[model samples]
Target: MKTLDFIKLDEKSVAPVVESLKQLLADFQVYYTNLRGFHWNIKGHGFFILHEKFESMYNDAAEKVDEIAERILQLGGAPDNRFSEYLKIAKVKEVDSIACSDEAMSNIMQTISLLIEEERAVLDKASEAGDEVTVAMMSDFLVEQEKLVWMLVAFQSGKCHK
Candidate 1:
């Protein structure tokens, strides 16, 4: 087996971003589960619409989670996936409480907003450290999260209401 040496980050330089990435992964996992919950439990005039949107968002979140975890592993760090560790590190809160359409939209917006901030922070650190790979990953995530935020905002604004 051959290992690639594509990354130029030293362990010391990568430490903060790796820690931040771990936190982001944990937050995203919780957000993903919450999206699933909203998808399953959402009820209102826009039930089908919200359900489908939640599913799409959750699916994208799941992929991002995988990507983050894999990046951590590539950096020779462990990917924190345990719920206990997630609870400790995640900035996003888990929502087990059922919510109405407006409440669910609010929750989704809040989660996406937090993610946007976290992703931007990671991108900034990556850029400062000249870590192109991390910056690229963060950029991709930023686009996805921005789209999710826009959709949730539109829904909350009744622009997407049908």
Candidate 2:
């Protein structure tokens, strides 16, 4: 038997919250992957600026993904990584096409909006479940994600254009 320190929850009580965390992890992975794709493939007159910005965003997302997976593991749950698993669990969409600069910005803005919503929901669930560790982890992620969303929204809205 694999010996483990499992934080016991009232499974019946927290089952829905646990399920939501699983879904959140899947969504976070998809968003992280998409951010990396944007970092690698972004091209245009503003390629240099957008490329660097996307790289930073993706790096931050990568860290958050690791943190989320670790939290799931700590909760005695296996983090989902299979494509089918992600497809079913994720609330975030994996865009199937590469877009032009304007479209890319719009896509990122939309994605960030969804991400922010998901993060807030997760935070609330974590708190309600009395999972303080998960709540704190999500709070950290929420702040960073909120900042990234604002940055992306500003760029998309031409507020960053000069």
Candidate 3:
């Protein structure tokens, strides 16, 4: 039987979707690791805020990682769990260290922008395939990420959200 036969989606139609999601999963893995490192190594002014923010972002990323992996399984694809694969496939490059608050937030914004682009591509594929579940997931991700971009911009401008 075709891999997606049970789900009623043409495997051919969903194949690219699955591949795109696997790439997204790899990106999220790298993003999660980078956030963790930023949280630990953030220094200088606004350290408290950036540190807390990085921790929160990384925590969110961890949840997203799981969600992406589960989605891949739901779509009849194996979730690639190897970091080596992530390094090879992810567009979001890993940072060695971000010592400045501004630079760290900038890095985050750049990464989020990349993710937004990726999620939009996934959204389009899922929409074309009539995969409402994946479409909704991508929609939700886009909403949250767009808001994050705005908020991060404000934060970088030295404006506190509260």
Candidate 4:
């Protein structure tokens, strides 16, 4: 018997999907932490702009963290809430506190890019198993993240004029 049985989504097919989602969840947790560090330590001329951006990003990340965890639960798997587990499983490595505006933006771009890759993996797995729910979730995530990549790239390109 699975928690998702009522929804017609068996736990068997979702096992692999749940595993992938766990990895994505862990990556998100680490990314969220890095965003917090950026928000707290960003300095210099772009401090005001970057600081607010980082806060908004982390706030969004926090919501995503909850969504991922809830998704895991819906798939009949336990959400790994432990930071220790996140550190062990996440490929998104933690960064030291960043004060430089350029460094902060660079980290955001890099980490979010990696996140896009992971989201695609999850989407692929969900699609494979005919899991429309998870597929839609991952699709939504990918679309939003891709747009974020575009905006960040635009921001980085504008730095050339300086």
Say which candidate scores most in TM-score: 4
Instruction: For model 1, give the 10-residue run with minimal summed lDDT.
Output: 1-10
Candidate 2 global lDDT: 0.72
| Highest-lDDT candidate | 4
Give a tens-digit lDDT track for model 3, residues 65-153: 99888988888889988999899999999998778887888888999999999999999998898888899999998988999999888
Superposed by TM-score, candidate 2 places the C-alpha of residue 123 at a distance from the truth, in angstroms, of 1.6
Q: Which ten residues in a row have the lowest lDDT in candidate 4?
A: 153-162
Model 3 lowest lDDT segment of ten: 1-10
The TM-scores of all predictions, comma-separated, are: 0.90, 0.82, 0.93, 0.94
Q: Which regions in candidate 4 have their CA more than 4 angstroms from the true location?
A: 159-162
RMSD, every candidate, angstroms: 2.7, 2.9, 2.3, 1.9
Candidate 2's TM-score: 0.82
User: Could you give candidate 1's per-residue lDDT for residues 130-151 as a string of tens digits?
Assistant: 7788899999888867776776
Candidate 2 clashing pairs, residues 3+ apart or interchain: none
Model 2 root-mean-square deviation: 2.9
State the lDDT of candidate 2 residue by residue for 1-162, as single tens digits. 221235655445455556667777787788777777777777777889988887877787778777877766666567876878888868778865563677667777777777777767877887777777777877887787677777666766765445
TM-score of 1: 0.90
